[model samples]
Target: MEVLQILHMNKGNDETSYAQNSKVQRKILSVVKPIIDEAVQKMLCSNIAPIGSMGIADLGCSSGPNTLLLISEIIDAIHATSSCSTSFTEFRVFLNDLFSNDFNTIFMSLPAFYNQLKEEKGAGFGSFFISAVPGSFYGRLFPAKSLHFVHSSSSLHWLSQVPPGLDCQAAGKALNKGKIYISKTSPQCVLEAYSLQFHKDFLLFLKSRAEEIVGGGRMVLSLIGRSSSDPSTQESCYQWELLAHALMSMVSEVNT
Candidate 1:
């Protein structure tokens, strides 16, 4: 199956949905708030003129409370920095994600979100136009040189697709058998395939963003990462290992 076509977080407000289980993502946003603030601050302080309408995009913005939290934080930073000026009056906020994402849930929450914004930022608060753009961030999604500030959190580690040749059907056998992600026991080819995919996807991501982001635009991206040079390091792959183990146990029970 095509990963992009099938991949998306659980939808809705149910107990198993991403909206209910995204506390880790929320924490990630909190950890990166200062960096986001710093980027917005620098963007405002820059010489980019005609600041009446600022374009901002949160790529891979999964549906959840954290989806709007980033926008709120950006608005807060702008308010703090532009208190003395009226130059920044309009906001064009883009929330982007995969095609299968639960955009309806996000849209349903917009009315209340706007109300909160109005109540907190006051009547004089600048107008914002928020729209959802569904697609992969590995390619261009916005008009050329349109975005000023880009923010992505807890999302970039997702490659554009599964690394080539690792698919069991295509490879004639399971390459990284019994494991969904890199592990210490993963073969050299499996490791290299994943690494190559990441590098390729990341390069495309940067190139696409470069075309969409203005000359002085800033991007802040946060994702699960490893400190060591090894891709199979426990810091990065341990979660996947645990998940794989759980899945294997389920398969064993089914077979029995």
Candidate 2:
């Protein structure tokens, strides 16, 4: 098997299977961390509910080092909020990803993660009830009005799959043309379709969270974004093009 096929097989149908895309994923998280912190604090202070406790969920939480890094930031923020609030409140941290994801990896790693935090940062900081629940964040993943903060990074923009036929040739075309994703002149229809899917996915996210989060609950999302809303710009989608070629090459090799 080629390297990509091996990686895909390792994925095993998990949402977090996207872990293979680690470099870009980490880049996405780095850019969004500060924004999430601010949003969480605002939610805690807002007038929607008593600040006695908080529930924070990281949607599309993939397993690995990056997940741990994200949880650390969240724990710090929660502790800071708990310290300043007059009412004592506990904290719940939900790590959510697709059912196909390696939640087992997350669970197995948690004790170690917790131990490291306690040893490095001290135990008295913030009390966290950490749990990993398997589910797709593309749909509702929490109880209604149950969350105080929601955060996701690098995940929101990935389409469940690239548009169908995106890999297929025009019925009569040959592989000699040698391309799979964007060409110099992909029709506007394809771009618009992808954009529409993003919009729909984003709306579902908002709607689900609207009810799951209390009135003052805050959401912070950071994903790979376009330089602008223009759909036709190559700058906005160069990575998708590269990934397609990579996948296509893998498929070709596997069949041969």
Candidate 3:
């Protein structure tokens, strides 16, 4: 299956929806809030031409409370640092995610989000214009030099697709059989394929963003990672290991 067609989090307010199960992601966002604030402040205070209108892009902005929470944090940082001389009067906010993301859920929540912004920031707090841009961030999704600040959290570990030759059909056999990701038992070839895919995807991401972000723009990206260099380390692939085990167990039960 194509990853983009099926890679979204469970949608709506169901028990298994990403909206209900994203506490860890929220914690990660909170932990990185200070870094986001610092980056926004520096972007604003830099000695560049005065910005009357600012462009901010939140890449991989999944649906839920955290989506608007991130926007609110950024706005708060801007409000705190804005002086009469350096105040921005207009904001162009872009929320980006994959084509299959639960964007409708986010859209349904916008009325309350706008109301809260109005109540807290007041009538004179400037204009916020938000739009969603749907696509992969591994490639270009915005016009050249159109963005000033970019933020992404709890995303970017996703490759554009599964690593090449790891598939059963491509390899003519099940390479890394019974596993969904790199594992201690995965052969050297499986590890190399994943690493190569990551490098290729990441480099494309940087090149795409380079065309979209202005000269002095700032980006804050927080992603899942580990300190260990080994790709098969438990710290790096344990979650997938457990998931694979569960899936294999289900398969065995079905066959039995």
lDDT of each: 0.89, 0.68, 0.89
Which tens-of-lDDT digit does each residue in 1-256 have in candidate 2?
3211121213423554545447677877777777866776676565556546678888878777677788888776665665444343567889887665666766777898889878865776657789986766767888887787788887776655555554456657532244443444566655665667677877877888888887767788877655666644678556656876798899899999
Tens-place lDDT per residue, model 3, 26-74, is 9999999999989988888885454567899999898987899999999
**Sorted by TM-score, highest first, which candidate order results?**
3, 1, 2
- Residue pairs with backbone atoms closer than 3 Å in model 1 (clashes): none
Clashing residue pairs, backbone N/CA/C < 3 A, model 3: none
If scored against the real structure, what TM-score would every candidate get?
Answer: 0.94, 0.79, 0.94
Give the count of colliding residue pairs in each prediction.
0, 3, 0
Point out the worst 10-residue segment of candidate 3 by lDDT: 79-88
lDDT of 1 by residue, 91-210 (tens): 999999999999999999999999999999897879999999999899889999889899999899899888988876534768888898899999898999998999999999999999
Poorest 10 consecutive residues by lDDT, candidate 1: 79-88
lDDT of 3 at 19: 90
Runs of candidate 1 with Cα error greater than 4 angstroms are: 83-85, 168-173
* Sliding window of 10 residues with minimal summed lDDT for model 2: 1-10
